[model samples]
Target: MTTERAYRYRFYPTPEQATLLARTFGCVRFVWNAVLRYRTDAFYQRQEKIGYHDASAFLTQLKKQSDTAFLTEVSSVPLQQCLRHQQTAFKHFFAKRARYPHFKSKKHRQSATFASSAFSYRNGQITLAKCREPLNIRWSRDLPSAPSTVTVSKDRAGRYFISCLCKVDTEALPITPKMVGIDLGLKDLFVTSEGQRVNNPRHTARYARKLARAQRQLSRKQKGSNNRAKARLKVAKCHAKIADTRRDHLHQLTRQIVNDNQVIAAESLQVKHLVKNRHLSKAISDVGWGELVRQLEYKAAWAGRQFIQIDRWYPSSKRCHGCGFVQEALPLDVRVWDCPSCGTQGIDRDLNAARNILHAGTALLAGAESCSKYRGALGN
Candidate 1:
């Protein structure tokens, strides 16, 4: 099978290259902010929406201006890519897929994209545009194919990475007969239809005290001082570490689940609405239901496995898998319950939910002619 994947690697830049890259990042940020301001103003004043072409056409004039002449120091490719990104952001906003484009901040993550024309790879080294020396990259793995584009980014922790996007050939996994359903929760990341439970890593909670201490240290330092900067970096590193741990665990879990099951079913959770409960919000976010479902979805597609999401309002937890009897009031505190109709004793709520989900998903798949219809049904 053919696939498009991004390979990311850490790279160390020489002082000169670092300066140039920093300049490029600044220029990209500047262009994005400038165009956003322009677009916002035009939309409000003239009821006109600006687009990529208009932005690109105006870039030359922008660089020629006295105040913004510093933009000339960086390669024009990153500036153009910045405009393209802003344009894409606006498109997503209009489509209601994302929020409106906002001004880029220097304090946060900064990135610049390089198109095929902007970089060249030779003799196991890659040279970026306007740089004399190739970046010293720590290649963790070999690329399947030559990358068409690369994105360079610097995180708040002062770590630099380059992500290369390329098309690659993939060998499809062998089809399996087994199927399973998953119920996500705070206590356990998920409980499978096979009575298997993957405990939630609780990455944020694991390091919460350390993060709190680091944040406290950051707050104690006076703003604009070197100590404050160091403290901020510490906080960033802590956050990065937590995020990395969470992501690594999720990837491993998802990979194993997808590989084992030919058909994977899960609840279509309304996480945004669920997280409104302030008491449970932290725990809910820490579990990352959305991230898990997302991984299962894309990985399932890649593996040619069926991924079904039962409707959120399907009453999976309340319904007894044995007798298909629905309880009128099943409270969250009721972890174990006996089904009145089926006389099923001591059934775990999460396990029952998983089984019910699998039953519903299989039934829907057998009855429905189109998967798109089921997807639309869940969306509603």
Candidate 2:
């Protein structure tokens, strides 16, 4: 089996290289926004009258009208990759995954990138095609053999990264017979059917106060002053550090889960909806529920294990895991209860919920047609 992953590296750019990098990033942004506009026009025009062709042709036309000439200088890989971003947006629209294609704005985030294999990376230095200076490399991982492309760009906080796209041989993991169901909650990050409850790290909230103070300091600084700029960098660095710590914790947790379980079952959490509800918003966001689901998904696939996502509204919390008995109402405050039907004492709410999730997933694995209506109270 073959798999693809970007091995990112940090590059140290000199003043001249930094300027050129900024220019390249700007050019990329311009192309992306232009393609978005073209796609939008094509969409509307097609609705009025069919005047559309393939996306590649539209991208080709944009290249002809390039402003920086830097756009033309970067290998077609970055250009094509840049265009692909817009195309992906268009695809999402067509597939009803998103409402409409949104315009790209340079002011929103990180500036530019050159994503092509044409950039030379040798002895900790990378040479871009149009630029005279070479970037000092901070290689994080091995480069793919015979890569189709590589991208060099800076992120929001002035950190440089390189993304290489290449094919690599990846053997499929052997499918295991074991299966486990996972229930996610604000109280605990994850609870397994086997009575394992992973504590909600709450890493984001732990550092939120400090982050808020940093932001306040940043806001007080004069916008154009060097002190203000340095202050901003300090804030950015702190935020990055927090993010890295959380990611590290998550990686260790997810890997442990994946390594232990075979057939992994989990509730399809309505994270976006849950976040909007003001009462538990902070707690909800703190746990990174959405990110957890994503990690479990890709890792399960990578491990060649059965990863079944039960319905979002599956009544895992309310239902009795022992007898599959449904309950009327189990409020968020209620942590445990005795099942009327089965007379089984529920020790912990999250564990019971996880058990229910596992049971429902098992029913699904057994080819059940219907799924539970809610992961919480059935009626709610």
Candidate 3:
């Protein structure tokens, strides 16, 4: 049986080590933005001079620009990879899978990494290519396949992370009879088809007062002063804490669901599009739909469960689970409703939706190819 896998672990790095990692990340951003600018300029020139333009010819040459001292700071392989990504993006755009190209910004949280870069972990010492200073690490397990490289990253809040690209052959999860469907909402985190409720915990919003006070202190401090930097760090730490708590809660909940079930069905949410509606956007963001689906994806695969994704337009909410009658209009505010046909009253919206999601999910599981077609229809 085929099984999915990943590389997971934490790292221990000193302050100096972190700075070095940050510099490498900067180098990657510099290369990408530099080429991005070059490509845009070339395309504009071509459009003006001739009738049409091509990105490949210019991007190909851009990759090797560092050869004659044009871009000395860039690693050869990484720069080539960046150009390859541009080419790939264009391919996807032409295929109608993605949007047209856009510019990269320094202000945005970003990083570029080369998969060919050396990363060796022997005992507690981890060595990076061309960098003599080795980082300290305590790996939780003996890796099955050696990691070819590592990606060092820093988020907007200035927290550091390194994703080790090691390989492992996870055993296929044993099968069972249990299957479940879940509905996602803001007021309530999740409601399973079996009546299991996971309450929504708004970690970030819970600390809104503390965050406001920190901003007030930050505003009062003189710009470029040591005190200002310290205050900024405090805010970053607070944001990080909330994110950590939310992740911990998600991990624990998903683990329970995956371990106990052999089949899992969920909605295919268009999270990016859903966030555009400003009226309920904050509530949607607080619900954390994207993160929840992401965790479910890998966890389901790890458990060897049949993971089914029904259509976003599946009308999971407006349809009655007891009968097949569809309610044409169910407002967001009406949390509790009764099925007129079956006389089932006091039906909780989230729970009823979960049942519908499961019904759709179960239909998909019986025919694996149909589920694949369903995902393909969504351009997955």
Candidate 4:
């Protein structure tokens, strides 16, 4: 099957390239914030909707004006692309898939997207518009094919990265008889139906002291001073380290799971709601359950594995997988329990929940009754 994949690599830009990219980033941010404001005001003040074409026209008029003519200095592709992105963001908001579009800030990570017309790729090298030399990229891995689009971004840590979106052909993995269910948690990253538990690395906690120290140092530095800027960079580096470690671990874990299982079942957790509890919010966020599941889903698709997410309210933890007995309550502290109706002793809570998830997911894949009807018919 053919799939579009993004491969990202770190690069050290030349002095000239860095200067040009900074301007490009600033231009892109300016365009996005300006267009978003225009659209927002049009809707609220005049009851007028500004579509992409109208926004594009507005950009053209803005560029020609003497006051904003500096926009014409950089390549226009990324500016135009930003408008398209804004349009998509608005679409997602109206469809309830995402929140309203927000103005881009210069302080955060900045990126510019270059479509095929705006860049040239040849012999494993990429040259962006208005640049004479190809980017000096560390070829971590070769692209499967030439990229359809390239996105260059600089994170808060002052590190540069380029992401290439390429079309690649993937062959499905060999069919396997193994199947497993996953239960995600804060203490243990995940427990499998097969009785395997993966320990949560707690990446953020590992760097907690360092991060705290850096943050404290940043707080002590006077605002708008060079010392403060340096201190802030130190803090950003600490955060980057934590995020990098967490992302790497999740990738490895999900890849292993997808490779071992033909059918993967997991609970569809409402992470947004789950994080609202102040007591466990930090632990929950650190565990990266949502990111893990997201990786599992996409990796499963790539490997031709069956991935299933049972409903969030399916009561996987409360239901006894062995006898279909439902418990009135199962508190977070209760890690082990006995099934009263079946007289099953010493059921591991996470494992049992994984098993129940597997059962429910299999039933769903078989086109069985709805969750409500299934609950009603339990133990029958």
Candidate 5:
């Protein structure tokens, strides 16, 4: 089967290359903000939405203006891609999939995309338009095919990376009969129906003190000063470290789960709402439940496994797996519960929920057409 994948690598640019890339990043950000502002004003004034083509056409007029003539210094590919991205952002906003587009900030990470036409890869080196030397990319692994698109980004910590998106032929793994359900929680990363518990690494909590110290030092520095800039990078590095650790943990866990199970079931958690609780918000965010679910979904799909998400309000925690008895009100503190209807006692809530999820997913797969509306089946 053909699978699309992104390969990312850290690249060290020469001083001259860095200067050029920085300029490119600035131009990309500027174009994004400019197009977004124009789109917003046009929509409000004329009640009309313009797309990428319209934005691209507007760029010609923008370049004719004295103030924006310098925009031609960088390769036009990245700027055009920026406009395409803004168009997509607005499309998503109009479709209710995301919030309204916002202006890009120079303080944050900056990225630009180079389509196949804008870059060439030859002899283990990548050369982009308007650049003399090829990019010094550390090829950690070999690519199976020429990338369709390449994106270059520089983070707040001053690290540069290139991500290439390519499609490759992959052999699907043999289907497994073992099916399992997963219940996610802050205490434990996840509990499987098969009585397995994966501990939450709590990356953010582990580095909380270090991050706080860095932030405090940052706050003490004067704004726009060199010291403040250094402090900001330190803070960014701390946040990046925590995120990297969490992502690595989730990827490992999801890979193992997907490889072992043919059908993987999980709860459809409304994490945005769940994180609203002031008491548990920190823990909830630290566990990265949403990221875990997202990883599980894509990994399972790639591995030819079934990934199913039951309804968010399916009462996975309240229902008894043994007796199918559901308590009207099960408080968050009640980790161990006894099913009064069937006299089943000492049931671990998370484990029971996992098993219930497994059962529901199996039932839905077996009877998709006749499945009840209450237990919605979301699978890929």
Candidate 6:
């Protein structure tokens, strides 16, 4: 299948390139905030909905004015792209898929997207609009094809990255009869139906002390001072480290799972609601359940494997995989429980959940009759 894929790499910008990119980022942010404010006021005050074309026209008019002429100095593609992005955000909001769009902040990570016309690519070199020299990109891997679009971004830690979107062909993996079910938890990252347990690294907890010390040093420094800025960068670096490590680990783990199994089943967890518990919220977030599921989904699709998510309301943990007997209550603290009806003792809670999930998912895939029977037996 031909799919659009993005490859991101860290890049070191020249002094002149950095200055131009900084200006471009600021311009994009300013345009987004201004257009968002305009649309918001128009909606509440006059019951008007500002579309992308109208916003684009507004941008053109603003450029003609003396006060905002600097917008024309940088690449115009990214500015227009931001307005389109805002339009998409508003669309998603009205469709109830996302919350209302908000104004961009200068202190946060900044990015600018450039369309094909705004940049030139040749011999593994990329040159943005209005620049004489090509970007000094550290090519980690060769692109399958030239990119159709490019995005440049800078994080709070002052690291620059460029992402190239290119079209590539992906072939499906060979057919496998192996299937597995996974149970996610705080103690172990995941438990498989086959009784394999993957340990949760707890990346955030590993760096908690260093992050707290950096934050403390930042709080002591005067706001707007150079020392404060340095301290803030330190804190950002710690966070970046945690995020990078977690992402890398998830990618590796998901790839292995997808390669090994033809059918993968897991419970559908509402991470937002799950994080409401103050006691377990930090641990839940540290485990990156959402990220794990997301990676599994896309990678499974790319590999042409079946991925199933059991219903959240399904009694996976409480239901006995041996006899289909459903327990009334199974507390989180009780990791080992016996099925009273069947007298099956020492059932590992997570492992039982994984087996039940596998049974439910396979029954679901079999037919509606089987699913109905399974649900009836489980009282779900």
How does each model score on TM-score? Answer: 0.95, 0.85, 0.82, 0.98, 0.96, 0.97
Best by lDDT: 6
Worst 10 residues of 4 by lDDT: 371-380
Candidates arranged by TM-score, highest first? 4, 6, 5, 1, 2, 3
- What clash count goes with each model? 0, 6, 0, 0, 0, 0
How do the residues 181-250 of candidate 3 rate in per-residue lDDT, one tens digit apiece?
Answer: 9998877798999998888888878988998888889899999899998888778778777778888889
Candidate 4 matches the true fold with a TM-score of 0.98
| Per-residue alpha-carbon lDDT of candidate 5 for residues 94-158, written as tens digits (9 for 90 to 100) | 89999998898999999999999899988778898888999998999988789989999999889
Task: Write candidate 4's Cα lDDT for 219-313 as tens digits.
Answer: 99999999999999999999999999999999999999999999999999889999999999999988898999999999999999999898888
Off by over 4 Å in 6: 369-373, 377-380
Give a tens-digit lDDT track for model 2, residues 309-374: 888776778777666677789888899888888688755778887877777777777777658323
Cα lDDT listed for each candidate? 0.89, 0.71, 0.71, 0.92, 0.88, 0.93
Model 1 accuracy (lDDT, Cα): 0.89
Ranking 3 against 4 by TM-score, winner? 4
Candidate 5 whole-model C-alpha lDDT, 0 to 1: 0.88
- For model 3, the local distance difference test gives 0.71
Candidates 4 and 5 compared by TM-score, better number: 4
TM-score between model 3 and native:
0.82
Give me the candidate number with maximum TM-score. 4
Candidates 1 and 3 compared: the better one by TM-score is 1
Compose the digit string of candidate 6's lDDT tens values, residues 1-380. 99999999999999999999999999999999988988999999999999999999989988999999999999999999999899999999999999999888988999999999999999889999988899888999999999999999999989999999999899999999999999999889999999999999999989999999999999999999999999999999999999999999999999999999999999999999989999999999989999999999999998999998988888899988998888899998999999888899999999999999899888887763544577785564
- In order of lDDT, best first, we have 6, 4, 1, 5, 2, 3
